[model samples]
Target: MKEYIDLFNRLPNLIILEDEPLARYTGFRTGGPSTVLIPTEESSFVEAYRTIINNHIPFFVLGNGSNVLALDEGFDGVVLVTKRALNHISVDETTITSGSGISLSELCRVALNHDLTGLEFAYGIPGTIGGAVYMNAGAYGSEICNVLNKVVYLDENGNYREKNLSELDLSYRHSIFQAQKNWIILSASFSLEKGDHDTILGKMNELLNRRIEKQPLDYPSCGSTFKRPVGSYASKLIDECGLKGFSIGGAAVSEKHAGFVINKNKATTSDILELCHYVQHIVKDATGFDLELEIEFLK
Candidate 1:
């Protein structure tokens, strides 16, 4: 690992940092310092992985950092940040191609600019392309699966390849990535439909406006805390159990939306986890429904 650090110091395309705060990098703004941080450029990403493999060092890929809850102890292993560095977007008529690190909101805007209509439903979602594809993220009855044609990824063996949408097994906030280990999404192709620019912009505005009006956007959160159960909404279940506005330390279920657990003020990762567990337990006890977490816990 020391030799790998030395090698990284010599590599121009990679920037390495030690004892860096994971909080500053994540959307939640709530973790301690990480042992090592590496931001690699497109030309250096594969090489960076090779170096980690050769050195037998544990490493994890991170994008936008929106859907994660990093512990206060932080990550002890190597943290690979792919945001900004891998952000690339290209659009051609009804197709949009984006790098894994590209933000979903940015991709939606790109589609809007190109007069593409299918992505308007995702206009206000925060997170990167790879994160969206991995979770098969959805909103307003539209999902990544609806527009995804195929995805290009680095397989478990670190070989580059592509797969069709049908092969991904995308379903209700889950994808093949959930079961498959060691694979990293590199990019994806999305198929959209052509529409009038004004109409596309109108739809985008409507979705964004709805999100702002209904969600607690003023506070920090990992968005929705739980996935919707079959034929039921998690928020409705929690609300029926009177979990809304419930607090655990600094974390609280949003007064505005029962689905979200927000950092009301200086909330710790522990607080969020506690609130999530409480909600799950209460909802299960009251309604016999097991609420599955949508947020990814990172430690």
Candidate 2:
């Protein structure tokens, strides 16, 4: 691990920070330190990513870190950051191809700029294209699978490959990526329709306003805390269980939106995990519904 990290540091235009705090990269803002690699160039990023994958080095590919909760003790391996490095987006007629690092907000803006429609559901999301692809991010009765045409990714062997939309196994807040953790997303293309710019802008604004009005955006969170169980919504269930505004240490269920678990104060990783567990327990005892977490807890 040390040898490859040192080698990555020597790669031109690659920014390598040893023993860097995970809090600086993640939205939770409550984790210890690890070695983080921030790619400044595409070639360097690709080389480092391939090396880490092919050599079986312990590593995690992080996007905007809006959906991950790192452990308090932090990771012992490398964290590959792909925010500014793999940021590329292009339009080909009605198809839009974007690198995994591009923020969802920017992607929506680009779609609107091209007078394209179908991605407004993701307008207010703070995650990156990579995270959205991995989780099949959705909102307002729409999901990424509805428009995604294909995915270009690096297989477990660190070889570039492309897969059609049908092969991704996309579902509500789930994707094949969860089962194939070693497979790294590179880019994806979405099929959209030419629409009136004003119409697209209006749709985007509507969803953004909905998020702002209902969510506790002032605090750090991994968006919704739990997946909606069959025949019921997680937020509605928690609200029924009287778990909203419940707190453990600095972590609390959002009073504004029961679906979210926010870092209310200076929360610790333990605080967040414990609070989530408490909510799950209470909700299950009250309603008999199993509440599965939507956020990824990284150790």
Best by the lDDT measure? 2
Which is the leading candidate under TM-score? 2
Q: What are the runs in model 2 whose C-alpha is more than 4 Å off? A: 1-3
* Candidate 2 local lDDT, 1-299, one digit each (tens): 46767667657877888889999878788789898988877787888887787677789999999999999999988999888688989999999999999999999999999999999999999999999999999999999999999999988887899999999999999999999998889899999999999999999999999999999999999999899899999999999999889999999999999999999999999999999999999989999999999988665
Worst-scoring 10-residue span by lDDT in model 2? 1-10
How much is the lDDT of residue 221 in candidate 1? 87
Query: Which pairs of residues clash in candidate 2, taking residues 3 or more apart in a chain or in different chains?
Result: none
**lDDT by residue for model 1 (127-164), tens:** 89988998898999999999999898877667888999
**How high is the CA lDDT of each candidate model?**
0.84, 0.91
Q: Please give the range of 10 consecutive residues that has the lowest summed lDDT in model 1.
A: 1-10
Alpha-carbon runs more than 4 Å astray in model 1: 1-4, 36-40
Candidate 1 at residue 237, lDDT? 95
